[model samples]
Target: MNDTGRQSRHLGIHIDRTVGEVYAYASDPANLPAWAHGLGGSMERVGDRWVAESSPMGRIEVAFVPRNELGVLDHHVTLPSGETVHNPVRVIADGAGSEVVFTVRRQPGTSDADFERDASAVAADLARLKEVLEFD
Candidate 1:
């Protein structure tokens, strides 16, 4: 938890792949459906923004950090209720592989269990990413 008493957490996975490879896949908005379960099924570009169907949350907007070799994958998600959440993500080299981390911020008035569930969801997505990118 940070000084503001919000449950900001970092969830990550170490993949047996290069940082570039991991970054390439994770940084693509089109690839969100394959791993980002919280963001619903499909996504598309509208004008200069990316929009996705977020199941129960209706359609939401997403914006990603500009492409960079620094492995920064920070993105912003605007919920249906007009709330924007900043998601700080990164892909970094780790020994023979790479580490991908996503930061989940605590929404206003979020309960403890809800926060844990959110972290668990991120971990699950990372596992899905590793499974998809590390195929033999």
Candidate 2:
């Protein structure tokens, strides 16, 4: 059994937009910085994948999965000593509105402090998304 502690936060909102419209925007990695606060760079498409370079983190791969009821963003960030952290951003639609969940799984032997720090960042990202989608 996988016993690693995984931290997750779920944020839901009922926007005045359709599921398709919301999924379209959330599925595009290139539009991340537009809604993700403190994002300092652009997301580029490499072959069939996407990559983004953040302020504190270097380059990282961005994956997208679009479904009838959900959209998922998966990526890994490298830690100080070459270890990697897996972050999954999930978006689920419930009729008119959608729910965004951020799951950050700490690498084995990694400290809880690191997970907390990343969790804060994920929270900010979700807030930014809410502001943009609700306003537009």
Candidate 3:
């Protein structure tokens, strides 16, 4: 699929942890509620999928890619409206530490203000992730 017309912004934060350490923690859907507030404040594992009932966007479903060594933490978020948004996340080595990057793409009908709000939420979530991994 051609994505040339899609507007995307990559938001990232540096973490005081190794790539493996960050990947292992962030790639686990069970650990999301603690750090990924952008997804929701509460999450539960139901069968093979993680369900978030208190998400800002209402009840949603999240499905992450299978574990891998390449630091790919990509996931799919199924919105309350049944629209699935593809979130591309990655953890990469940065010397002795690592950096986590999340790509926020503006949906077809999303307004500029909403897109920025979404970006801010992702940024906050990344900050929280760093705090959890580095200090907690």
- Which candidate leads in TM-score? 3
1-136, model 1: which lDDT tens digit per residue?
3443466888889999999899999999899889888887999998666899664479999999899989999999889999898999999999989999898888877778888888898889889999989983
Where is model 2 poorest over a 10-residue stretch in terms of lDDT? Answer: 6-15
Evaluated with lDDT, which candidate comes out highest? 3
Model 1: per-residue Cα lDDT at residue 50: 86
Count of clashing pairs, candidate 3: 0
lDDT (10s digit) by residue, model 3, range 1-136: 5453399999999999999999999988889999988678888898778999999889999999899989999999999999999999999998899999999998887887888998998999999999999999
Candidate 1 is scored at a TM of: 0.92
| Model 2 agreement with the true structure over 8-110: per-residue lDDT tens digits | 4444444455666666777677788787644446877786656666644666655555444546655554444566556676666766677766665655655
Model 1 segments beyond 4 Å from truth?
1-5
Candidate 1 Cα deviation (angstroms), residue 64: 0.2
Q: For residue 94, what is the lDDT in candidate 2?
A: 66
Candidate 2's TM-score reads 0.71
Q: Give stretches of model 3 more than 4 Å off.
A: 1-5
Model 3: which residue pairs collide?
none
lDDT: which is higher, 2 or 3?
3
